[model samples]
Target: MPRGKARTAATARKPRAPNLPAPFVNGTILKDLRKKEWKLGDEVGKGGFGLIYLAAEDVDSPVAQTAEHVIKIEPHSNGPLFCELHFYQRVSKPEMINAWANSRKLKYLGVPKYITHGNHTRGNENFRFLVMPRFGTDLQKIFEGCGKQFSKETVLALGLRMVDALEYLHENGYVHADIKASNILLGFDNKQEQQDQVYLVDYGLVLKYSPDGSHKEYKEDPRKAHDGTIEFTSTDAHKGVAPSRRGDMEILAFCMLQWLCGKLPWEDKLLDKNYVADSKIRYMEDIPALMRACFSKGESHGEISKFLTLILKLGYEEKPDYNKYKTLFKDGLKKLGVKDEWKLHLPVAGTSAKKSVKRKSEEASECSTPKKKVRGTPKVATTSGSLQHTPKPAAKPRQGTPQTARGTPQRARGRGTPQTARGRGTPRTGTPRATASRASIKSPMKGDSVNSPQTIKSPAKVQTVKSPVKSPSKGNNSKPSTRRKVKRSRAKKVDAWVQTSPR
Candidate 1:
């Protein structure tokens, strides 16, 4: 063999070293690119591509376990940390987050603030490290500890905050391709004032959808298909398309669904990427069926259905209406009789509600509701018309019953005895009235009513309605009979509609 061929063969047989950073000793100090020194403490944890260390400013003493900051380190040759470092330097500066929050009139934003990053050398190897504020336990642990299910309130609240975070990233030209429970972290120190806030961390998979003020064209690469967590990844990701704003929202919707419903429909078939993607496509096309598959009959979540429907309609390069998405969550919380206090309530994890940090006078001014700018007359007219039309339909149903009752009796008496037989149909009119009352009572029990009020009322309502005639119950039998009539009528209508509609 020639000398060049022999050399290539020898090199091919050589063993490669793993791409990991060597652990540094406690009390080691390293200076950042800005020449600020940060002292490393004990090794606290490990990441997918690096080691996490408790860190603090270079000081006279040792770094404490309760250090206010952490440093993630990896070998210089590793690409993940370098990519994350650039993301932090470009989009996550402290001033940028503060400015965005102020401009948006928000009390708190969940994007983790970037501190500093620099290169370091130890022995003969070079390493890269980035510093950030320390965070408490990740959401995954709490999710598991809570039996893998979060309350509806918690799910909506988390979703609202995540939307804020993702909006901030998208505005700044980045997409968080990997959003999952493991990447969401509670605020630092786990203090009472900080529990309400959750930071979106781990930007290693972050991509810039828009560069130089132009959105990237939609294209798929077979090599990059199925690029994120299999079960929760967006269908776009499953198809190997580059992550975009819609992809981020789609991933977040899956996360919120899993948090509320405990699992997803395609979770069982996650090993088959194409199957999972196909299932998501089918469900997106028919959100009601998706809700039925996840929830029991008559227990569908309207808010989640609406959210999924809106995001699935987004085009590849289209900007999302962030405020509309927020309204969906806010309305859901309102139906649940709660306000979005920006505090997360994790009952299974035993997290108590706590007041957030006091706002500065400037922040208070920013938080005040802004005056609405008057738009065109047509828009204002449309808004008022919608508001006026909303209550009219509900009121008409109530008002028409009395008029029908009075008019029917006069007509029946004027006609004949056969007409009188139809007039004695007071029971028919009474049944609709009963249904209206029941609907009024049940309207407040939307969203997760199944896990709450329905659980409490189901047995009693079922028993009372089952044997109303045979039981010795007096006036109670009348109410149950009306309810039974309403159920039968509704079932008949549903059967008729289903049979008449196309398959």
Candidate 2:
């Protein structure tokens, strides 16, 4: 074999070691390329190939728990950190983010701003580290805490934010290949003004689709097949095609779907990448079927369905309409009676209470107004009179009953026909008359002169005697009356009430 071929054979024979970096001692200081020193505190977290430490500007005192920055360290041999560092250096500077937000007239953007990064030597081992603004718990943890599902409003709001971030990345000649819940984080400080903000992190898989102001050609490489999270990876990724703007949108769509529905159709078969890919392809062809599979019978989200449909139609090299995508989510939020206030509506990290309580309280306040109005009306008028009698013609002119019931009994009596009919007669003539008429067939009240007119007007009143028997509890007497005229009038009112009450 030639020398080059022998070198390649030897390189292939060597096994690659894992890229986990050794933990650094507390209070350690390191200088970046710019000569700015950062102090490392306790080890806050660890990922597959790196460790995260709370960091602050080099100071005489130790790093505090409230340090506003963090350092991510990985072995020098690791490729992920190297790739991420390059992406951040080239595209995620503070000036870049601020300019984009200002140009777009946005209050804020979700892209994580890169700080300083450099090489570090601990013991005999070399490491690469990057400094970034510290962020709170990621969306994955919140998603799990929320029973693996988010409300429709929250999902749309999050989707809109993600689109804004991805659009910025795309415009900067890069694509975030991995867009999952784990990579999206909320603001670190719990300040009320910033609580609504979220930052997208973990740029290890970031790819530059347009390095020279020209989109990359569509092609597949078998060596890079199935390169992302199986459950949410785009169809092109499964086929080993290079990542593109459309692929990012497709991944985001899957993420939003999972957030809204709690799970994906291919989630159960994630281990089988080929099956997951096939499932996604199958669903993409029929968006309604996909919606039906994820949602319960007779339930569907038009916004989600439309989003998926638009994404499925995108070509491998197509430039996604980011504004169109945002419109779908914004419209969805409106339909859900929500506005894009940037609030996440998720549970706070390390707490049993949910952040969604504020939203729920707002909804409760809105609904409470109508309840107060309902309660202001007389209980008998709303429950017994309006609810039971308003549907009938005979009861149409008795609107004064509910209004009069709110005033003194004297006002109800002074209202004349409607008021006196409801106030005095409701207790005795309304209920007891029906009860007595139904219980005993030989009762003289049936043959009494007071009931003679009701019986003569409609034979239907006789058949409905059993109906009013069910409504005996609705009657309430204010005062006794001995006037034969009042008794006679009460009997006639009772006939109307009994006819209208439900059986």
Candidate 3:
């Protein structure tokens, strides 16, 4: 086996993503495209190396509304030309084929459609520009705009699909160095699937497996370059050790943990798990998964902790048998009185082509426009430090507002955006809100928003007369005050239903 990393069994299933020529402004190709009459429109997205724009090129005439395209323009500098041309020239219809393959499904993983690429020149410079379809929203933007959560099932289904995509890439001998919510595209294909399917974007750092079996990998190998964000990076990457499939798994594990728990693994080994494992850290990565690495109140509790435990257990070294998990899910869902819990048939890859899937309640939640208030389990608040200001109500709806618009297939709701500014007006990139505190809902920015109030931020501050609140069973904050009383008079009202649910 090549020393690098083995693509997990999952990634090898799909075709390699096409490597189209990256474009740039003031390039010969841009001039050529200008000659071809491709007019640039608004800026679509940004990358450190290039800028993506929405463009329209007249096929027949400049006046005619032609096809809209996402054009990529790399920054001009002294680097490469022929090598760049060769790589982009190698790009082809694989992207087109990918688009065709996913056109029909409830494709919520928001990836832009691939169009074409070409050479161009302008203002004493020459470079390449590539084109693709356009839909302009990311998970980050969606969370900023909408704080809605998917059903529990939506989170699971979407999580599995993301793993599948990663597996497909790995199988093809490539590793998505950066895997995070911002990198995951949304609102590109289906307006609704933005919340369902997560599009994996920005493959610039992707490591293509070297053909020679001598490529580097994790300690098992030694030459691999560490590439990825420090926050989500794996133990091997941190150690300057080679990378392998486990590296990706570690990153994947980190992403999953962040989704459910709101923080990175805390144990000191989390900082250098592979290094420690190679030394005397007896359990290797096991401790980090259990939060034995570090312990902070925020990182260790709330709903995120609850589900992350389940996911971590799923990743144990001993091959996980999801059958029992599925069984437990079946029973738990049944006990929760989930309706329409039936089997669905899906097309399997090369068999007689039949697979059964269960349709859970969260699917309906995605499509349920008229939403109901869920008296959820207590969670941590993203805005813990600030006192919630009683701002004047605006056009935005409450968390319980029904979403009649159907998002893609059911996904797990453990994931939501945390709109905290790291103290600056500039917001931090999305963080998990599965257990967000109530005080965090201070922001008013608009997004097609995909997150919700499902988080367990602070139970002490958020609940009101309109919605039922679950008191911490044994926290120091609990008191026999009027706030704890469920009953409210006309001067303040209370609900009788509070007596039934497990308060």
Runs of candidate 3 exceeding 4 Å displacement: 1-37, 59-68, 76-113, 143-154, 189-194, 213-226, 265-284, 287-503
Instruction: Compose the digit string of candidate 1's lDDT tens values, residues 1-503.
Output: 00011111111122234466778998899889998899999998888789999998956788987788999999888777888988888988889999999998888789888899998999898888999999888899888776677888899999999999999999889999999999999887643226688989999889999776888877765556677888888877766678999999999999998988888998997766667877887887788888888886576588888999998788878998899999999988889888664868866463321111233555676665352222112342232212122333333323444432332232222221122123334222223222322222222222332322111222245334323322122354355665566567545543453355343
Best-to-worst ranking by lDDT? 1, 2, 3
The lDDT, on a scale of 0 to 1, for candidate 3 is 0.41
Against the true structure, what is each candidate's TM-score?
A: 0.65, 0.65, 0.45
Error of 3 at 192 (Å): 8.6
Give Cα-based local distance difference scores for all models.
0.71, 0.71, 0.41
Off by over 4 Å in 1: 1-18, 189-193, 350-503
Instruction: Pick out the ten consecutive residues of candidate 2 with the lowest summed lDDT.
Output: 1-10
Q: Candidate 2 regions off by >4 Å? A: 1-17, 190-194, 347-503
Task: Please tell me which model should have the higher TM-score, number 1 or number 3.
Answer: 1
Ranked by TM-score, the better of candidates 1 and 2 is: 2
How accurate locally is residue 41 in candidate 1, as Cα lDDT from 0 to 100? 95
lDDT of 1 at 457: 28
